[model samples]
Target: MSKPLRALDEAALVLFSGGQDSATCLAWALARFGRVETLGFDYGQRHAVELDCRETLREGLRKQNPLWKERLGMDHTLALGALGDISETALTRNAEITMEKDGLPNTFVPGRNIIFLTFAAALAARRGIRHIVTGVCETDYSGYPDCRDDTIKAVQVALNLGMDSRYVLHTPLMWIDKAETWKLAEELGGPALVSLINQESHTCYLGDRGTMHPWGHGCGECPACALRRAGWEEYVAEKARA
Candidate 1:
C-alpha cells in the first residue's frame, strides 16, 4: 500500500489576489502547507474584474481538490481603501498602465503590497500561523518599487515587529522569472497549475478576456503585456526545443 502524502504541518496565509502569480503561489501553498487560508483585498483596483476571477478560481479549486481545499479553509475579504482615488499610480489613478520609462511605473501602487502583507501578517498571527505566502516576483514584473526583494524584506521585518510575532514571508516566485515560474508550476502539479493560470487567472489590468494571448489578457501594448508576452514566448520556445 502507498503511504499517505506527508503534510507540511505548518499553517500559512496566502495574500491571494486572483492574478496568475498569486494563483500559482496559492497552488504551491496548498501543496506545501498542512493548513492554508487565502485573503483577497479590494483596494479599489482599476481591474475589479479580477475579483470575479478570484471567486471562480476559489470555487473551482475547492471542487477539484476537496481535501486540500478543506484543509486550506479559504476566506475572502474586502478592505475599503481609496486605491483609485488617492494614489497617482496607473493601477489606481487615470494614468495609463504603460512600461516604466523613468523609475517605478505609474502602476506602482505605493504601499499596496505592504498594506496587503501587513494585513495578512496580522491575520496570520491571529490564526496562529507562522507563514505568510505571496507571489511578488522581481523578475518579469512591472517596475514596481514595492515588488522588489528589498521591499519585501523590509515589509517582513515591519510585519514581524508590528505584530510582535515570528512570521516568515514566503515568496515562491521571488527569484524566478515568469518562464521559470511557469515551469515551477508544472513541477509542483503539472497541468493543474497551467490550466488554472490560462483560463481562470487574470493578469490584464484592462480586463480583456477575448484573446487567448498565452500570457493572459492585457492591452498587448502596455509594459505588463510586453513582459507577459516575452515570458510566454520563452515558455513556448523552450517547450518546442524540449
Candidate 2:
C-alpha cells in the first residue's frame, strides 16, 4: 500500500460510473483529495440507467453532506456512446453475454478503461489536477483485461509520457474484492454513506433495479450482480465474526 496522501487543497478527478464500485471510489477520493471532480461516460452501455443513478447519487450526496458540493466539484458526463456503434459487446449489445475470443466475457468493452482514463487525464490536465481516481477492481473483476493492475500501470506510464504530464492514476479498489469495497465505504464515511450507495448505485448489466439482493439491487444472474452479492455476503459474515 502507498503512504496516505495528505496534500491539503489538492484536486482529484474520479471516473464515476454510479455503480457500487465507482460510488465507493467517489467517497474514497473525496475523503483523501482536497477537491474532487467526477467524470461519467455515456458509452452506449446496456444499463443506461446508471447514468441517471450517477446524477441522483451525486445530488443525494451533496444534499446529505452540505459541504460535499464544494469539496466535490461538478460531475461531467462524456458522450462516448458512439463506441457502441463500432463494438458488438454484450454491454453495448442486447445479445446474451458469453465468452468471446481470449476467454473474456462479451460484456467487456474493448479499451474502455483506456479511453476513459485518457480522456480523464486530458480533462485533469486542463484543470491543473494530477490525481485521477477510478474504481476498477481485479480481485473480482470478472475477466476484463483492462481492469488488471499491470494494464493500469502501463496505461499510466503511456498517459504521462504521451501527454507530457505527471498524472497519478489512483485505483483504490484495485486489489480489494467487493466485500472490502463495502468496508472501504464504511471507513470513508459511515453506515449512512454505505446505505446511500446500496440504494442509489447501479451495477446490473441487465438494468434490472427491481430485484433487490443482499449486496444491491440488480438482476441476480448477471456476473456483476453475482460478484456484488457474494462480496456483500462476505462482508456481512466478516462483520458478524468481528
Candidate 3:
C-alpha cells in the first residue's frame, strides 16, 4: 500500500491561480497541512479577469472560515511576468485556443509552470517551509507538455538539488483526471471547493462572464471548455449514481 503523507508541520505553499484545478488543490492543501499560503501569477494571459476572481475567492475563504485562516495559516501573493507580450502561445496571443491539433497546443506557455513552481519553491524555502503544492495534471490537461507528471518529477528533483533542501513538491492532481479532481473536492466536504469552482474560477481566454456556459467562462467550444464539460458530466453522473 502507498504510504500516508508524512505529518506535515510546515506551511504548504500552493501555486494557486483561483481556477478549478488549483482551487481543488487549495482545498486539499488546507486539509492536509498545518498552514497554506497561496501564490498567483499575473503572467499576462488573455484572461486577466481570473486574477480578480482569485482575489474574491481568497477573500471569501478568509471571511467564511476565519478559524481556518488563523489556525491553518492562509495567505496569497501575486507574481507578475510579461508572458503575454513575450509568448506567442494562444493563451497569451490573440490566436484561438483549440484542441484539433496534436502535441502541445498554442496555449502552452513554454516554461510557465516551471517558472511558477520555481518561484513558489523559493518562497517556501525562504519561509522555512518545505512543501510546495501545485495543481498541474497530465490526465486532463490542455495538451500542455509542461503539465506532465514527468515534468513535475523532474522539477521536484531540480528544486531539491538546487536549493539543497528537503523540499517536497506536491501534485495532488497529477495522476487523476478532471472528474477525479472534482471528486477530491467533494471529499473535502465544503462549499469552499464546489462553490468557488462554480462561481469564482476563470478558465476562459475571452473572459466571458456569462452563466450560459456550463462550466463557467469562455466559449464552451474550446478545448479547455470541452475538458471542463466532460469532467463536470462525470462528476454529476458519479454523484447521482452514488
Candidate 4:
C-alpha cells in the first residue's frame, strides 16, 4: 500500500458496519488518510451481531500496523430502528431470503445507503471530518440500486450542496468484484488484514456465526455467504496460480 498522503486535517469517516465490504473500506481509508474514524448504524438488522464485530476488527486492525493504530480514530453507532419499522425486507425481519418478483433480492432495504451516508455526513460535519468512505459495490451484486456508482456520485453532490462543505465520498470497492475485494484487503494490510477479515467480520444475512467456513463464519446458505465463499475460493485459486 502507498504511504499515507492526506494529512490529519483531511481525515475520513468510514461507514463501517463490521461486514466484509465495510471492513475493507475502513482499511482502505486507514492506509491513505492520516486519520480515519468509523460509523455504524443499528437499523435493527437481523445481523445486528455485526455491530459487536466492530470492536474485534478495530482492535485487530490497530495491532496489524502501528501506522494504522496512530491513524484510527473514534467509532460511533446510531440507532435507526425507524428504518426497520417501515421495511419488511429479509434483512430487517425473519422473512425468507429470496429473489423477489421485482427482480431484486428481498435483502434490499429501501434508502439504506442513502440514509447511512446522510447520517455519516452529519456526523462528519460535527466531528470535522472532510471525507466519507463506504463499501457499496455494484460488481458482485446488482440487486440494490443504492449501491450503484451513479447513486454514490449523486449523493456526494447532494451532500456537498446541502451541507455547504466539500465532502468527498470514496467508494474503494465500487468496480471490484468480491474476489477482488479479498485481494484488496490483502494488498492494503497483508496477511494480518486477510486473517482479521476472515475471522472477525460478519456478513451473513441470517446472522449465523456458529459454523465457520474457509472464507469466514456464516450460514453458508445466504447470498452473502455464497458470495464471500466464492470470492475467497477464486482469490485463493488465483494466488495458487501465481
Task: Return the top candidate by lDDT.
Answer: 4
Residue 139 alpha-carbon offset, candidate 3, angstroms: 1.0
| Tens digits of per-residue lDDT for model 4, 1-242 | 33345655579999999999999999988888888999999999999999999999999999999999999999999999999999999999999999989999899999999999999999999998878999998989746999999999999999999989999988888889999999999989998899899999999999998998899999999999999999999999999999
TM-score of each: 0.89, 0.95, 0.89, 0.96
* Candidate 3 lDDT tens digits, 1-242: 14446445657888878678887777777777777888888877777777778767666666656544653454556555665567887777778765435666677778898988888888887777888889998878776788888999899899899989888888888889988887887776464567667677877666666754555666776677778888888988987999
Candidate 2 C-alpha RMSD relative to the actual structure:
1.4
- Better-scoring candidate (lDDT), 1 or 3: 1
lDDT of 4 at 10: 73
1 versus 2: better TM-score goes to: 2
52-102, model 2: which lDDT tens digit per residue? 898888877777665576688877889997787888888999999787678
Q: Tell me the lDDT of candidate 3.
A: 0.75
Score candidate 1 by lDDT.
0.77
Q: In model 3, which runs have C-alpha deviations exceeding 4 angstroms? A: 1-8, 63-67, 71-74, 99-102
- Give me the overall lDDT of model 4: 0.92
* C-alpha lDDT score of every prediction, in listed order: 0.77, 0.87, 0.75, 0.92
Clashes of 3: 0
Which parts of model 4 have CA positions greater than 4 angstroms off? 1-9
